[model samples]
Target chain A: MKIGAALCVLLLSVIAVHAAEIATADRKSGFEFMGRDTQAMQTDDTSNPGMLNVLDGGALWERPEGADKKACASCHGDASQRMKGVAARYPAFDATAGQVVDLGQRINLCRRDHQKAPELAYESRDLLALSAFVARQSRGQPIAIADDARSANALMQGRKLFNERMGQLNLSCAICHDDNWGQKLGGTSIPQGHPNGYPLYRLEWQAMGSLQRRLRNCMIGMRAEPFSYGSSEFIALELFLMQRAQGMAMESPAVRP
Target chain B: MPFKVEGDAIQRSLTGQPGDPTEGRRIVISRQTGLCLLCHSGPFPDERFQGTLAPSLAGAGTRWTLGQLRLRLVDGRRLNPDTIMPSYYVLDGVVRVAPSFAAKTILNAAQIEDVVAFLSTLRD
Candidate 1:
């Protein structure tokens, strides 16, 4: 038991080292890179396009579903009460699955077990809406991705993927997000690419999107084929991103260009 | 020779007189060709929002010999295995390369020379 405890300490220290290795210069949020007008759009709930998705999620939260005919509200009551701070803890280690599960996966799990509803399609309207709504409950809450023993390995893996160069462009996420965040890439100001403002509405996409969808967009932009939605790579990457943005305020329904 | 491949590196001429600086500068800013601006800020004062990821190319010509610049453009992995910079002139042994881009160097020989020429001109 002593040796086991020592090994656990050793492993956690390793993860701590890796987690702390994020460049100091990469501390800015993606929101910091937005133009003035774009920044203004995200600040106002009415002007922010992402609020549309969040409002849709509010409607979905109470709607009935499945063989049990129960909505998410049936057992939980008001999400603002029960679901607060929930989004901030996700992409956490799921012991039963023996791997990291992102917020999207966790939501689907609840949908299956509680709502008895069919899983929403990846990036589907209902999924985006629901995620946006739940994440909105945690607005202004500091992000705190899981860092326990169960999550250490996935966090390291995600960190490696973020730094490793891939795609026809031969750029890693770090090149733009970490090294040159305040600079410009093409016409847009390059951001630190944190996951804080996800379930965001993008002007380029002209729609609300989850963090996974944004990851897929970067993958496509790098000219690499995107992994399947909810794939381990995406989950691990999401875990790393959340941990990377560990202390930033949540901005789930943010608007972006 | 436009360039000669060495063990894990490439060597070329300083005074080869092959590439055009005017053409090279144009390609450096072009998104499809040199893509120098994507990761590097060059000597363009009027061009705003230059990248800060890689080192600025403002004094590149004075910073290194033509041979060093050529080696980097040809295959930067030789200098740093983990460098995010692409091997612009290497055409094989890469994984997950796009189908349209497979077996093709990112920049042609002339374009490489052009980029080198442009980079060398950043003496100030």
Candidate 2:
């Protein structure tokens, strides 16, 4: 009887360990939580409204601009070849800038440094198009944000922001996403808030948008003041989200409800 | 108007007069006003979709007294600091409020009274 009781306790502990592992390690794309129609829209390139932005982005990539008359294509050549797997490692620490930068900000840096052009406005058609164009090359690749010592502080800050309660709602991202995901909020099932399919189409917005736009919307919904575009806080949060989404398949220009 | 918090309950209504239960019901279900259904499910049969976050409001009236209900509606955090429910009538200690929502509570004094009146009608 004593041996049997010990065995039962051992089995229970094993089960508890397994549950904890699943909670921390199991990653589900927002795609899984979406409906069949939305899934179909995401899968079919021709049908996906986000593809329109991608197409426009493709055009923007080859068109020369700025004082130096340099298009992104001039330096990078074909995006399919040069930019593949690039988006997977972004929100990276840039030593020159002494800060972390997401893919959109990196593109702006390139335009300023190489193209000698003005920075594109946040959420502008041109910026979204360019980002979508670059990110499309990384579709189907696994997210693999690098572990750099330079970005350690930013990553820590990101993690803090994700767990911190904000606004009048006093709810953290972890409260809904980490704790209560798969539960319904009003009519909609709460998604895990993955960052994989960013620069994607959201039916609620009825337009293609960047991750910053979505973050801002959630803050507004929570009655919190949103961080400005290109803010360090937003970049840090992106770094944390990308790290959290590491190894999830990249699905840029994807669709969401 | 000043009110008093006695233990887990508020002994006085924010508004001097009693609120209409019908108006309270409307505010409770409204997407714009109360936003209660966003994180709470209730006994409304006609509402197709309700939240599954907080406890159901079906037995709320039977669960607590009117004063207790009033305190919760005003600010649940006074009891549970880590609650996800917004402090509908609190304007202090909130940070980074959006420009449009700055210096405003989720519900006004009369609105709080109305919501309390409506919630008080919820019996198991």
**Candidate number with greatest TM-score:** 2
lDDT of 2 by residue, A157-245 (tens): 98889887788766677877876788788867998888998799999999999999999988888889999998988999999999998
Backbone clash total for model 2 is 0
The estimated TM-scores of all candidates read: 0.82, 0.91
Please give the lDDT score at residue B22 for candidate 2: 98
How well does chain A score by TM in each candidate? 0.88, 0.91
Q: Among these predicted structures, which one has the highest DockQ?
A: 2
Model 1 TM: 0.82
Q: Please report the TM-score between candidate 2 and the true structure.
A: 0.91
- Report, for all candidates in order, the number of backbone clashes: 0, 0
User: Model 1: clashing residue pairs?
Assistant: none
Per residue, candidate 1 scores C-alpha lDDT tens digits across A176-217 of 676556666654677778888778899999888888888888
lDDT of 2: 0.87
What are the runs in model 2 whose C-alpha is more than 4 Å off?
Answer: A1-24
DockQ of model 2, rounded to 2 decimals: 0.31
